[model samples]
Target: MTVIRCPGLLNCDVVEVPHGLRLLAADGRSYLLRGLSADRLAEGPLPAPLAHALDRLGLLRAGPTRTVAVVGSGRLAIDVAEALRGVPGTVVAELSDDPATERPGGSWQLMEDHSPSRLTPDLVVICPTDPLGLRPVLQLCRERRVPAMMAWCGPASAWSGPVLTESRPGCQNCLDMAMARRDPLWLATAAGLTGAASCWAGRSWIAGQVAGLVAAGCDEAAWAQPTWASWTPRGHSSAPLDPHPECWWCCQSGPAPVRAESECSAVSSSAA
Candidate 1:
């Protein structure tokens, strides 16, 4: 058990990470939350100037000079706001629609209820709890030409790179495939995600880290370093484009040919 008192705690409303764990006090709480880093840390080693960099150069600092409105109150959204405090952007948690769905591009409008003229977001962060929030907003962001990214939340079957609007390789559908292949144990608990509040503290931490990537990806300087990495170990599999014609999204050159009887729906790339 090692601990470091963070000086950065003096400025922020709360204690910063790697140091804040000591404040949790409960052994179990500390245990479940420890050693999640993809990189290893030796005990009692000198703490990096992490607290300082985290205080100054977190998610928001990586974003555009424009006001950044963090849309949802989900763990990632709140964590992004928390990490980006005093970084010169307006952060809001009002994008919930009824409860789960966030009004897509609410950040551009500067309000949860009002729709923006278009999804030309300087940066849009999606932390959808389920596909209900994911698909609709993804479709709309595509329609409006928003350069957006999705927060990596849970275990994925194959996993994708930083979900980016600029490229198709690093997209949500790849992450979706990764999830389908993973073992259910990866879900953690039935409350693997019960609500915005009840999810495992560990999961919350994971979401926050990935959301940090989402934040940093928005800022060109941060992303140029290529610092972001996956939160968990991933299994790899070959997913090739269909030899047969495909949907307009994936195969732009050729429209998918009509299917034979019992073909049912289009075969997902994961199957290929």
Candidate 2:
């Protein structure tokens, strides 16, 4: 992976991405330094550097469900699968691209050739190291009228859990559009997600925390709205997702209609 210096005098932490390393600064600024040979930042658009920095901070918002499909690999995926094992009244599916890859422990199925049963899982947890890998599962879940959550636990003490769906206000696409609108560098960062540098590692406690959130969400726990939840050394925090005015998912033909129903409740009932 390529290593690069942060332009400002900011405290930067290195985290693995899909292809290369991402430098996350203390100021909530992030930059993708791709490839081992690539160094110096390329000259680009006006205010690109400033915009990239601003894209960093913010709690991700989410909503959740039941009958989960945990889409990911490595330790985190295995941990989540194991944690969800034998939970009464819930069916969990652990999917991956590789068919013959040995799973650590828990019930997992080959996704390449398997078709889900008619009783599809209503919730999907996306934790794949590759950000682009999220697309297929999300698309599949959306087609089945299911909700998907983006979850991860650290190269350090941080964890994020955000739920997404095209039919509602808190979908990942909405989050992306909102971020892109706020910062010009967001689009560029998104494009490099799959090809950027990333590593596989996280703390056990953090993983457990994420898995618990997923489970609690599925069990219809106290989280009542589309909220972004996270954990740090200090404590836990959550915030509601704000729909973008021009979001295609929330506002298709015209302005989005006022929804009396939460995304999870509405879609789960319909899918059921």
Candidate 3:
């Protein structure tokens, strides 16, 4: 038995297959190298076949988002909005509790309470300090037929998502159900925890990861798949969000209608 570990390079098992040398990627993918022309293989200490395998496995891909509406008056929400800055054509706005007191700031717009009714942005991001407090926001997004993403940043420096998206598969209710099932005491525990804490103690890096996902989803990029990501001592791991067949929230709602360009054109208009 032989094993090779390249720090920041590749982690795999070197196995002798009938086809010659093969690399079983840490992600459960296996790549085989049969033969490579001399020129095709660059001048590296690693064999051409192994180098080719490395090249095949090493690029990162992400999606681009356009317009996004952020809901919530917490630090996490503000952090997410800030992260969207500098992306071309990406508009970030906050839904204010008081319309009269609200003022627009750099790179972000401010909207009154019923902002959702006015703007049909590509995606809505709800980042509430109390993850359980998103019922109303979730309901509004559902009624408006807009796609939404939710995030929960909490103490202990742990983060969950940019959760699932509202439209394609997962809904807030579905997420609730899943969380409930995953931990029978989740509701009680979360309530108690949030009740005692005035502000969430989530770490910046974790929040940034989730925020990036929210922005990408808003961009409607190809790699934008709804997932539940969590950070642990080992590292970060993600799992796909699945729809529940008996989800009352989603079942009751029909597919979001496609608003004509003219109707959605006034997205930047007043919520009044």
Candidate topping lDDT = 3
Steric clashes per prediction = 7, 14, 3
Higher lDDT: candidate 1 or 2?
Answer: 2
List lDDT for all candidates, in order. Answer: 0.38, 0.50, 0.52
Error of 3 at 94 (Å): 1.9
Q: Which candidate's TM-score is highest? A: 3
User: Model 1: which ten-residue window has the lowest total lDDT?
Assistant: 263-272
Q: Ten-residue segment with the worst summed lDDT in candidate 2?
A: 56-65
Model 3 misses residue 218 by how many Å? Answer: 3.4
Q: lDDT tens string, model 1, 1-272?
A: 53433222222122225633322322232222243231222232112234223434331123234334344545555554454443333243334423444544334233222355332445555655432244455545555545445543444311223333434433444343334334343233323443434234434454445434543335554433212233334322234322122233334423334655221121232122
Model 3, global lDDT: 0.52
Expressed as tens digits, the lDDT of each residue in 1-272 for candidate 2 is: 43444432223555656666576756677767566222322332112223223333321112122567777765566666655553323456776634455443222233332466453566667665543245555555555666667655554333444566544466655554555567666445444554333323343443555455553445333334556655556566667778766544556644335656543223322222
Model 3 CA deviation exceeding 4 Å by range? 1-65, 97-117, 160-167, 195-203, 214-224, 232-234, 252-272
Residue-level lDDT tens digits of model 3 in 1-272: 43333322234554554535455666787766565322222222243233333655741122244677777666666766666553333577766423353524321232223654556666667766565765556556666666666666665435554333343566555666676667767666766656333333354554466445543334445335556666544466677777655555555556444444321222111111
Ranking by lDDT: 3, 2, 1
In order of appearance, the predictions have TM-scores of 0.45, 0.51, 0.56
